[model samples]
Target: MLVLTRKTNEAITIGEDIEITILSIHGDQVKIGINAPKKIDIHRKEVFIAIKEENHEAVKTVSLDSLKNFIRKS
Candidate 1:
């Protein structure tokens, strides 16, 4: 992983499109602001993990074979 220290208002550019900046620092938590294209997706790590876990549970409980049989008969 690439790690660097940046003070408030300092920014790091991603490729040719995205720019991530440090907005503020409070205690141990740092506030960040991102500038990216509309097509790009941005999510906090915990939120991303939650979304992934929810999708996994939904898939595990869903009947894919039943849906496939119905589609085949249709």
Candidate 2:
């Protein structure tokens, strides 16, 4: 992991498109802002993990037979 220390208003650019900036600092809590293209997705770690887990569960519950039946009904 690349650890960095940034004061408020400081920013770091990723590749050529994304910019991460420090917005505010209060004791241990720090607020940050991200700038990226609209086509790119930016999600918090927990939210991203939850989304991945949901996708995994969905795949597990879905089967070819079920899809075929549904398609036949349609």
Candidate 3:
């Protein structure tokens, strides 16, 4: 992992398109801002993991037979 120390208003660039900046620091909590293209997605690590798990569970609960039955009714 790449780790760097940054003070408020400092920034780190990723490639040519993304930038992360320190917005403020309060006690041990630090606030940050990200600059990226609208087409790119950004999420907290925990939220990303939750989304992946939800997708996996959805796939497991869906069956081909169920889809076929629904199509037949349609």
Q: Please identify which of the two predictions, 1 or 2, would achieve the higher lDDT against the true structure.
A: 2
How do all models score by TM-score?
0.83, 0.86, 0.84
The digit string of per-residue lDDT tens for model 3 on 1-74 reads 99999999999999999999999999999999999999999999999999999999998999999989999999
Candidate 2 per-residue C-alpha lDDT over 1-74 given as tens digits, one digit per residue, 9 for 90 to 100: 88998899999999999999999999999999999999999999999999999999999999999999999999
The lDDT of model 3 is 0.98
Please report the TM-score between candidate 3 and the true structure: 0.84
| Lowest lDDT 10-residue stretch of candidate 3 | 59-68
Best by lDDT: 3
At residue 66, candidate 1 shows an lDDT of 80
> Candidate 3, 20: how far from true, in Å?
0.2
